[model samples]
Target: MSLRWRITLAIALVSTLVALALSLTVHFAYAYRQAEQARQLQTQRLELALEEYDRTGQPGLRSQLNDPKLPDRLREAASEGGTAAMVTQTPQGAVVWAALSTTGGDTLSLRSSYQPQLDDRASLDRVLLMGAAALIATGTGAGVVIGARLSRRLRHAAAAAARVADGDYSTRVSAAVGGRSRDEAAELAQAVDAMSSALQNRLQAERQVTADIAHELRTPLTGLTTAAELLPEGRSTELVRGRIAVLRDLVEDVLEVARLDTATELPELSDIAVGDFVTRRVATYSSEPEVRVATETVVATDPRRLERVLANLVSNAYNHGRPPVVVEVDGPRVRVRDHGPGFPDEVLAEGPGRFRKGSGGGHGLGLTIAVGQARVLGARLSFTNADADGGAVAVLELPVSEGEDAPGR
Candidate 1:
């Protein structure tokens, strides 16, 4: 539940409990007080009656017992409508003989007048009433203070979250209950801030990479267009042709990276002979011969994405490897090894952290694009320097599917 609502609920519950306690105390206390008052008042009436009886010893005084309307008066007072009672004994010896009708049912009458004394007050209504009021008031006050503090904390956290949502990652809530601990709200606020900060950093890095790619593509494009002006005729023309091909490769890599980076498409999967797939990729990219052997290797994978991955890896190796790219297939596994100067230490350390090339030539997004395509096809990509003597090894493991790679599944 929201903190605001919880705090409000807590306040309401405390108030209800306090009110109930007070009501019970008031009811019990009023009853006790009414009972005490009736008894005291009855005692006073009894003393006067006894005195009257002592003064007029006619003995026929039983009929005119000092009070003709005493029973009705006592009954009226006792039936105060708040506390029920009987007119009970007044504790005077011989006072009963002086009495006439005991409408109080004779159970409350005394024999003769005795010395007046205070009754035991073991259960004082006043003390109980005061105690209940004090306890309830104190408890309610404490609850109010706690709820207020909790609400304040929630408000602070809510404001911080709103600021973060508005793209302000620097926003933070204070971890204080008048300067103490940062509760659950504060922790959540802090987490949101951290996540926004990290996302912002990543976006900035992507922007930089985008800018670099645009600049690199522009130069190659201009060169290819400028060289196209010279007609295809001799050795110089052949050089221009090679340059044109390189420019095309660069353009294709750039487009591939763009697609990989923002792919909103899933791969079409199929069960393909892994060895044959490897042979096709090797033949497509490698000028040097490639080898493929069939094994119990079958994988459900998108052929096009797999092809792209193999093409990129092989092209990368051909550009840098010494010669001879070897392709091998195992159970749901494929490996491409190059007899090149392996991979640069820099490339190995960074591991597909886009736009880092050691040869100082490639678009550098080739391996990154390949890796992304592999991921979309539910595949794995790995790279390692083959031997201590230097050469690059690439592993691509694709999951086998039951159908052919095609459009619309």
Candidate 2:
């Protein structure tokens, strides 16, 4: 059951048990009081009966003893030489009877009918029962009200959490949900709000630094590349030019990654055949990699970003793993796998992050950029070691396209 129902039932049960205990206490106390009053009246009647027995002797006493006014229980007590008392319900309401033996051979008995004490006790029982019912009803109502309020507050917190998980750093638990209440739920809301704020600030700072670094490196890199090109043609000059080109590419990649981080690079989605797209992207690679088209399917995606993702995967495979680098498209998904000592355990387990690369790996932003681009397109990018070939595989599952035509159509 939900928290609301659990709390409601718990409160009702506890309140009912408490009410029952109190009602029982009152009921027993009233009964005891009525019994004491009956005993006292019986004692007085016994004294009066003994006096009458001494004065009138057996004849008048016998008539009094056999009086119809007395109850059966009292008559028995008086005739036998012992004490007895009983309360019985009659058409005229409840009556109390008591009897005792006198010093003489006769017995004394008393019948107190229309006794409010006994009758009041019965009335009190009805009141107690009614009061208990009222208390349980009141408690259950209160519990439901309190539980619903608490559940709403908890749901608000949960919604805020979901927004944050979806990369919406601007979302926060609102003050109206609690309105300055310093309860535990309020504390949780406060904590989530603080966490989202901190993440937004941190990401903003990281994005700024990345943009600044990339901007700062571009001018010097251009000058270096021009200076290298102007040098005399020789082995040394060739090495220098190649190194400058690598540095230029690195700076460009950094800027691209920064753009991806800030979500500034919006995908220009278009309808394209999955097989043709993968084939065209793989054809650009210098390695002339093999391609497998398992099924012809169309997809809606940003051609430029998708090509960039495929290019990076192909480059990483050739640079870091044994070739026969293959690109495979099955339906709306593509896989780039290389027959090399798969991905290092750490990278596969912890996922690809900026500056986290394996031995002999490029500047670690490649896979990170791929992941960001995949996320922007509402796709899933996953890395795993292939089971049969024991090679690293990067699988990108793209969003479904609007078109359903086959490839080359």
Candidate 3:
């Protein structure tokens, strides 16, 4: 049975049992009290009979056989369940007097030769049984009502939670006065709602990212193919090589993003000095690289991911910015600044989104790849066009793991 029915049935059964026990106890008590009263009446009748017999000296006193008052007393005693019987004892033996009782469900035998019987009230007892049953029925009905309310509220909450699980984060249970608020159902609903909102935000972000990826990938692919076709018969060495390099960069950018997106390449993070890594990347850059730092730091990070992150940023700046790019390391992050015409209003507004770039003529995959890599590496990436001049800045933050100390100034 459903929880509601089970709960109702349990309550009803318990109530019935309690009522049955109580009714039986009351019935027994009444029976005992009535028996006591009957016994008292018999005793009083015997006392009165002895008194009259003493006054009249009636050893064989049958009240003159027709004394109406004596016979009437005997009849009254019989009616009251006294079962009046006389037994004569002659030192040899005594005759038996019959048993008597006010009510009878079982027969009683007495020492005297007489018997009295009065039927017990089965109808009154049946009425009490019916009354107890009626009370149980009423209690059961009340239990059913309560269980129904509880089950209804529970069902409502369950439905709402299911909807949220199916991605409808806007789902909410109606908070009536009698709701699942008294149990885990309320907490479950709240959790579902929260999960739905989070899912919505993530889906939206992924959609935007997908659209940007398409746009960004199209550029380098098209440019690389065009550059190949444009080769006027056995392309010049320099032109062919430059086009090939561009193609390589484009392919690497896509691969980098794919790996990060799928988490195929996990960050093998470990303790590494931030200054040393940045310095190495700066040295690798052919263009004049400027480095600035207010603090030197060590952070837990995948060195490979760290290197890739720095490479993407430096490459993006090199391609789009003027010479003498300024890279700075402070706190838990590194920032690369390009002293060139910074990003356009659209690119700046889009933040770290895909298909977004500075004045770089190639695909916008560089920054896109950067963002994906940072995500896989469990870091943060952001970009802003410079307000001071024509410089654009890219910020990459590495989250500090437990037991890692802060930057040392």
Candidate 4:
């Protein structure tokens, strides 16, 4: 359940429990007080009847004993005990008090019919019902209002967190509540804002360092390549040339990654047939991935960047996997599967990272670059092990270009 409902439910339950406790307390207290007052009044009436009997020396002197208003219980009390009192309900739901006493060996009885006046029990029940309803309404309203307010604030914090996760380092939680009232939630918002600022600073610093290193290495790297080309044709010269090429490529890849981190490499989106793009890119590789196109669709993406992504994936498969790299295009989605040992547990779990190589050769920026380009294209890139064979399967889901036919399932 959402936070709003959870908190509201808790408040409602507590309110009900408190109301029930108080209602029971009031009910019991009123019953006890009424019982005590009835007992004292009955005792006084019985004492007066006994005094009248003592002075008159005649049972008939107290005419109420003979009257029809007297209850049968009072007559029974007079016959059974010399002194006693009782409150009882009659067959018609009427309440009565009965008492018996003796004076000069003459039995005397007393009674008083109980009929509520202004403080009738039925009217009290109506009042109690209204009060309970008002209490519940007030408590429920307060819970909803409070729960909604808290939910709004928490949702704002959660949205800011989501934006930060989505690579929007500029996103920060607003600490508006701090100025008026600094509650726990406001403190949490402040903390989130601080964390976002820290992340932005650290990531920007890292990107700047990478860009600086790449820029510094390029001048010497070009000079070294030119020197290697001038060297006489020999084993040593060939080895040096090869190593220089590798170093140059590494520098270039680092600069590209730094650009991606800074989001300076925006996609030049264009309409390209998904099937054709897959076929042409696969042809560039020597391993020649098996291509399958079922229900082709067009995608809007930067062709060069898309080619780069395909090249890196195919290269990884050929170098690391066993054999038979298969590339399948279904609608706007492409899948590359290799029949080899699957991706490393860490890569599959933690996702690809720059400089973090898998169990393969070469610098680890290939998958990282691919992922970054995919983001620029507003597409999704995922890696998983094939269900049947435990081989790495990379899927790229691209957004459909405008005015293109919708992709079939």
Estimated TM-score per prediction? 0.46, 0.75, 0.45, 0.88
Q: Lowest lDDT 10-mer window, candidate 1?
A: 93-102
lDDT tens digits, residue span 1-409, model 1: 6655566667667766776677677766765665566556545554555455556643231334334334454445433432122433453421222122233323122232222321223244446556766766676677667777778877776776677654455565443223456666566656766777787678657855764785678786777677676676888887777777777776666656655655455898777767776766666542845676746565677888888887878778777786777777775677878787887776677677666765637757778888888878878888899766568988887765555332222
Question: What is the lDDT, from 0 to 100, of the residue 142 in candidate 1?
Answer: 71
Best prediction by TM-score: 4
Q: Largest lDDT belongs to which candidate?
A: 2
TM-score of structure candidate 3: 0.45
Clashes of 2: 0
Off-target runs (Cα >4 Å) in candidate 3 are 1-237, 263-265
Give the better candidate number (1 or 4) by lDDT.
4
Q: Which candidate would rank higher by TM-score, 2 or 3? A: 2
The local distance difference test score of each candidate is 0.63, 0.79, 0.66, 0.78
- Give the runs in model 4 whose Cα sits over 4 Å from its true position: 59-100, 105-107, 113-119, 175-179
lDDT of 3 by residue, 1-409 (tens): 9989998999899889988898888788866665555545544554444445456644121222223323333445455654564333434343323222223222122232112211354555887788898989998998999899778877887777677554455666544223434566566556656666787778757755754774577777777767776667654856776767776666666655655554445677788878777887678767757888767778888887777778878888888877668889886789998888776666667655555645567778777777777877789988887777778898988888777767764
Residue 150 local lDDT, model 3: 77
The order by descending lDDT is: 2, 4, 3, 1
- Decide which is better by lDDT, 2 or 3: 2
